[model samples]
Target: MKLHPTSDFRGLPPAEDALVRYLCAHAEALLNAAALLGDRPAVRRTARLFEELAETRQPLTRRQHAGIRDLHRLLSLEGVDDPDSLEAACFAEIDPASPVVEEICLLTDGLASRLAALRQAEGQPFGMDLSAAA
Candidate 1:
């Protein structure tokens, strides 16, 4: 079911909610990049997913989140390993007159880093802290 956009942020504390919105903005940035360079079928498909999510105001399911991660991985595989290569690779075949490619690459890399940190932070197994027991 689709969630209200506000509902998506409802239970989160202010900081966490802001993080969610920040991440959503990053996803939108990725979507913009996908639109600009989505000549490939896979990239086009991923863009469609991002579009749908944006329109529906839905929280990502595990599968959808995985798809975002996969898209980021694919972009990295496209030789975006560093700033110089990212500029060169992401701007391939584009007019040098347009200046957004570098920004897109920076956004992509930033999103990937944030996503990685979120994943790592969430990866810890759940358990009670019993160290205070006496």
Candidate 2:
């Protein structure tokens, strides 16, 4: 017997929810990066789990490709662990984005503060898709 999608998926404040929250919290900045690079008008909703395909655990999606690139650029400019190397690496565009998120997080509280400010200035609200449909 298959469970209802929502029933199968756990709500927020759980283990999976932790990761979801982490992504959601940062998504405001990440969304700007995505909107700038991707050619689509991003709606306030459906930014994270925009599609069922994203529910799968893959390295990164094609849509997310530009976002990851732009984020690395932004994070680097923000001096995310020495912007020079980050910039040089981004021009190459060969590295994956999953690893970069934590690196940016570790840069400093200042980077986090700046990211929050940028997101606020850009007027990005809370992330829409906080969790997948189980």
Candidate 3:
């Protein structure tokens, strides 16, 4: 995905705009790392998912956010001997100091919090109630 400037965020509400920009940047970072990692299966999977999400050019649904988070956690750098070194190498080519891991963490955390807030605003609890089941 082509990296979009913050100005392109027009039309989206402030919060959604920020989220979209962050996700785009995250996608670009992961995709660049995937490109340098060659044909590894995990990298390929992550690249595919990021590409799909980037092409959407819209805010991610909760399920899509969860899927990407899982892929990032489980497959983004799987089997890499030293992910920091790999990230450094990739970032050197794309962005010299773009901290992929931290960005991903912040983005996922923010999204999760936003979802929780939305649920709360709608009068829904954050999680299931075991007492009801019992």
User: How do the predictions measure up, each by TM-score?
Assistant: 0.52, 0.27, 0.39
Candidates' lDDT values, in order?
A: 0.51, 0.38, 0.49
| Candidate 1 residue-wise lDDT, 45-73, digit = tens | 66655554444333445555566565665
Give the root-mean-square deviation of each candidate in angstroms. 8.8, 14.3, 8.5
Cα-based lDDT at residue 15, candidate 2:
35
Better of 1 and 3 by TM-score: 1
Ranking of candidates on lDDT, top first: 1, 3, 2
User: What tens digits encode model 3's per-residue C-alpha lDDT throughout 1-134?
Assistant: 44443436455445445545555656655554455543355477665554555455455455455545445444234434565665444434544255754654554565555545544544568762212210
- Give the best candidate by lDDT: 1
**lDDT of the structure predicted as candidate 1:** 0.51
Model 3 CA deviation exceeding 4 Å by range: 3-17, 32-39, 57-63, 75-134
Model 2 ranges off by over 4 Å: 1-13, 41-134
User: Can you give the lDDT of residue 29 in candidate 2?
Assistant: 55
Q: After TM-score superposition, what is the CA distance of residue 76 in candidate 3 from its true location, in Å?
A: 9.5
